[model samples]
Target: MSNLHARDYQPDRQGTLDGIRVLDLSRLFAGNVLTQLLGDFGAEVIKIEPPEGDTLRGWKTEGIETHWKIYARNKKSLCLSLRDPRAIEIIRKLVPSAQILVESFRPGVLEKMGLSPDALLALNPSLVVVRISGWGQDGPYAQRPGFGTVIEGVSGFAAINGFADREPVLPPMYLADGVAGLYGASAAMIALREAEMKGRGQVIDLSLLDPLFAILGPQAANYRLTGKVKPRTGSRSTNSAPRNVYRCSDGHYVSLSGSIQKMTERLFRAIGRAELIDDPRFRTNSDRLRHAEELDAIIGAFIGERTQQENVAFFEEAEVTIGPIYDTPQIMADPHVIAREVIADYPDPEMGHIPMHHVVPRFAQTPGSIRTPAPALGQHNRELLAEIGISPAAYDELKLAGVICGG
Candidate 1:
């Protein structure tokens, strides 16, 4: 495999979001994703975990906290048992200095814990409070446990995801949580900008359900017009024909798309089947969609005769759009991925080196940097407490009383 781009932590590098502070009291994927984005852009993110740790820490591969390491980089951890009143007080003290606060608690849990948006906003009028849940804060299902899996099933994504003959399929990855995280990041930035301009804080009611549903793209309107539900067509496009993955002779796969008329003709010519372009069953996009099975059979046969690389080269030479379906190993070895440094290796104490994605949405002048590894649980307890005027004696007492733990 080609060497991955190697990078070292640059703790002093500044980003556009420098001086902004985020207090993250969220667990699992969505919250981490939001804070990670903020942290990458130079916000000082203080992850307030429970004594045990954020739930992401428990998601280990071969007993390594891979998920936590990736998501929690550029963050500081302050582990506290929030059930204890003292820990709650610590959060209240930190609120005055923090510009943003994020939590993924069920709708009323933060209110019950005495850290409601109103309370936090009162502490710092410019504080932006982001509440993430499975559903909206005041809906009928607001109190439901909002795991991403449940939201994925209900968001109508699974309904049209796989082959119609098989049962609906949930995504293999955290699709709901990932989408919500990206939405939350943008929403938080919007809210923060408003707060900065107006000196008034507000609460963001972010739900996994809403963001996931929004991205499904006019499903309700389509159903209204067609009076029919979309069927699960596996990799095939419902509106476009000749858009599917084809197997190669070498057991690899390549995805090909001929979504437009010119592209369909080009593809037909490339595959030495130019006559199919005018054939009654495959003349237009509508005709091809109606006979996609037969069309796929014809295209698949041509692709199946060649190896994946050969097919890719041949199609590119013929000016037809095509690409090999890449697994992780293939992705890591690709020269384009290497030169672009899409993934790079970073020094890690435990694993010696860990591969991580480069900072995203690169800016020309103020690019972000990874300044630190994921913190050991509670690694910043003393440092954070000291910032809030907690002396050594008080810090020791909090530890002794089990109000603080994990470092």
Candidate 2:
């Protein structure tokens, strides 16, 4: 049976976030990723797109690479041309009924559109507004046009991610955008909850820089306490020894971490070289780190006898921390991934059972759900307008004026 039909994998009839309504005014990856996440958690997200539609609509493959199809799952699209006063009026009407609003335009763009947080809050005192941007809304670079790669470079992540001998490598994925979206979503959720508690609303100014800054891990701490800045060390960490990726007999790679003494000793024992535990050159983490090349060579020689899978199982059995550097197919085929239902088969309106990477942070009673597929442009325009108290005559007038479009 398909995993979607597995008895235990059923979605909540009453999803934890079932009653919340989110108005998504964001575009591109960062904002869309956030709204998609909220929708997966059962928020009724109404995506308000401009008449030109999301630019990502053109982000396609000749065959089936629909970036919009995946990233925009579980939201209804409502098209409005904000240049028309009617379109602005319609969004103003919708704001009172929405619990949250998310936008990712440059600073001042939404205000120019007449959908500013202060304006919306006047209409709905409890509305949680989340504004996402590459830089913050108030920073010196607030007006600058930026994207994932640019911000990743500016945030110092790209600088410290590549091999020491080569130019700094850009991350394979849109790490900045995606992580910023997560931070925005989390901030929106918290702000919404706080607003509900206080009976007042606030705007969440979530910058892409926040996640880049937060994701620095130890780099920020090291920089804060000392005068030194971090450089690219490839797979090695700043705080530990024997914590780099290694090659196995099958020409596959794996990572092993052993910063603590007991774990390092265990790793030595697992390789049948317990004498290394007492060796002066590798007794402490500091010593092992100083002689990392020698220690890594010794470990690599032992790993040369085993396939990645064999090594993974052997180290796991021996209570050593290790992971096979899995490819996408390998990850999809992993037993633990299957057991966790990390991949979901969502029924798309345009296509059959489209697969999606499932939601995270599971709940026993009211977990998130993938309720609906992404809509075609302006798919829910009329319906959303009707829900927001627009009369048929007014809707027709707006459509005639090129202010509202969907039909």
Q: Pick the candidate with the highest TM-score.
A: 1
Candidate whose lDDT is highest: 1
TM-score of 2: 0.93
lDDT of 1 at 160: 89
Worst 10 residues of 2 by lDDT: 1-10
State the lDDT of candidate 1 residue by residue for 287-379, as single tens digits.
Answer: 999999999999999999999999999999988879999999999889998888889999988888898988887888888889999999999
lDDT of 2 by residue, 255-283 (tens): 99997889999999988899988899999
Segments of candidate 2 deviating more than 4 angstroms: 1-12, 63-65, 218-221, 349-351
For candidate 2, list the clashing residue pairs, or say none.
none
